[model samples]
Target: MTAPYLIIFDVDGTLIDSQAHIVASMEAAFSGLDLPAPSRAQTLSIVGLSLPVAMLRLAPDHSAEMRADLVEGYKAAFQSLRLSADGAALSPLFEGAMSVLETLQADPRFVLAIATGKSRRGMEHILDQHGLRPYFASVQVADDHPSKPHPAMVKACLFECDVPAARAVVIGDTTYDVEMAKAAGAQAIGVSWGYHSVEDLRQSGADPILRRFGELPAALERIWSLT
Candidate 1:
């Protein structure tokens, strides 16, 4: 029998279109703390980072104590937006994302998984909303692992899926994702319709930046060939 291939996805910019909601949450956090909110582009630039690191990047002049406070504030504000009384999901899966996920999950040779900067609770909200929980066999979240650009999340997913680094792929939108994947000796693939630009993904060492969800299967086949 052929060994299994682990196809790991990132949550925020990769699967779900949460950029607007994320910007709103960051703005709310800054406003509550009487701090100036970073511009949308600046906020988007730090999308894949953990809250503390993201806070520092957005407000580099602030002290660690204040940055920590911002983290808590962002969490509370984001949580409020995520769990409104009406129970509507803030972030919707991008076009064709669901179909791509379903196709990948149904493929017997592959094991679908997630490696993301979202907290476990946040990740749960996304998966539950999209009914994606059953498709993933392994999940690594910011709550359990260090922020991206670190190989820990990738390593954990490979370990959990019982797949070697050479047999796994990290599909995401940010440079942090590319760096993290390569750090673990895994293939890094980027999507163009994400927060970061295709140029950024290339500069970060991503091999092929897919332009659409429909291209995912072919991207997978090509990437697997290289491995």
Candidate 2:
């Protein structure tokens, strides 16, 4: 029998384009707390990391207490701004995302999962709000495990799915995802339609940097063939 393929996706940039919301919410958080906000470049640089890690990156000199305060501030600001003036949070999935997800989910050969920096509650909120909660067979969130570059979260997903590392593929838009996949001995596929530039993804050691979401199946097929 052929081995099952486990496709683990990162939430923010890979599956959904939440850059605007992320940046705007973060800026609001800083402003609300009277703290120095990071620039777009700085924000993009830490896209796939956990909240505390991202906070450390942005405010290295901040005390642990201040970091905790900043996290709370960011979450409050995000919750407030996520909803539009019309009282709805508009989350736009990337082009061809739904079709691709549906296609992959329907395939008997593929097992879909999520490994994101978002907390489990945060991820569940987005999935439920977007009507995408039923698709994934497994999910590993930052709050449940150590952050990316540690591979613990990915390993957790693998454990949940009962798959070996070699049978898994990690998909994301950031270097952190690629690095984590490498650490976990899984194939890494980076998406160009995210916070990191193509060059950045390539430099981060992704085997194939996908330009379109539609190309995901083909990329996975290629990786499977090699493995």
Candidate 3:
């Protein structure tokens, strides 16, 4: 029998290393709002969550008014920084990311999509800027549905791709991604190159955390074998 279709990736740390921009923007946001900013390590831990979720984690004691203010401040600061960088805000894609996508896209049995916490507009901007837009068949973004740790985003991607949950795998750098995949009844594959440590990912219930991007195709082949 043919192997099952596989792979939905989280964009931020999984494909592209945007941690610097993210943390900088977040720090700027906190400064603008006069709120205490989370440290880089703290911010990294919440990377896969939605903006609101990240804010809540960073400022759990914030009032509703404060939350609104912080959100607005964050958007303004982030946009300003991104614009000031002249489109250079994005970090480079992980090593072999393009090659892995190309290899998988070339295979008829494999399918690829994006499941990310970034807003649809945000994700589109990054993908288009990097000339990576055409590679994904479907994109599941925060604006389109609920955020990570919730299966809605992954479920939407599964629906868009017309694939059963059992045939799909979610690959990401954070624990939130693993939990979301588990909630969706899909396999979870974690990449050690991203924000979270390998031990953290393992504790998050990711099966077989991969140390390098080059191992992805073979790792995925193994997941597909089960379905």
Candidate 4:
């Protein structure tokens, strides 16, 4: 019998296309303080980091107090956007994402989990919004772990799912995800449809960089076959 392999995913850029909401909320947060907003590029670049860390990077010259305020502003703005009628459009699933997840979830050889930088509340909202709550075996969020590029989240998922690091794969759109999975002693697969470029993902040590969500099954097969 084949051993069960765990597939851990990153949410923001991997499964959900939330860039519009993210950029708008970031702009609103800065505007609330009369500060110059980060460019769309600037904001998207920090998508895989925790809110506090992201604010620190974007506003390095500001005092800690100011950064804290920006975090609150951003949270408020994001929550408001999430509750609005247009929320579905604000953060829809990427193309082929639903079908791919469904297929994976039905496979007995694999287990699915999520490790994301989203707050617990935000992660729950996304899960419920996309009917994804039941699909994941374990869900690690920023509320309980350090930001990405750290192995803490991935380690927790492995522990919960009872999967060895060698048999686990982290699929994400950012270099942060690649680094995190590597730090956790797991394989990393990059996705091209996210915030970071494919070259960046490759340089950061991700293998079998997938061009579409549908390509995941073969990527997983390639990674796990080596182990």
For each candidate in turn, the TM-score is 0.96, 0.94, 0.94, 0.98
Q: Which ten residues in a row have the lowest lDDT in candidate 1?
A: 81-90
On the 0 to 100 scale, the lDDT of residue 120 in model 1 is: 88
What is the clash count for each candidate, in the order shown? 0, 0, 0, 0
Among all candidates shown, the one with the greatest TM-score: 4
Model 2: residues with Cα > 4 Å off, grouped in runs = 86-90
Deviation from native of the Cα of residue 79 in model 3, angstroms:
1.8
Candidate achieving higher lDDT, 3 or 4: 4
Candidate 1: Cα lDDT at 221: 85
lDDT of 4 at 83: 92
**Model 4, residue pairs in steric clash:** none
Write model 2 residue lDDT over 53-78, tens digit each, in one string.
99998988989888888888888877
Write one digit per residue (lDDT tens) for candidate 3, span 1-227. Answer: 64448589999889988888788878888887767788999988888888887888888898867776776777776667667755464567889999988998998887888999987767877787778887898888888778788999888878888889988999999999999999999999999999988888899999879988999889887766733
Using lDDT as the yardstick, the better of models 1 and 3 is: 1
Model 4 Cα displacement at 226 (Å)? 8.8
Question: lDDT tens string, model 1, 189-216?
Answer: 9999899999999999998899998999
Stretches of candidate 1 exceeding 4 Å from the true structure: 85-89
Q: What is the TM-score ranking, best to worst?
A: 4, 1, 2, 3
Q: Quote model 2's TM-score.
A: 0.94
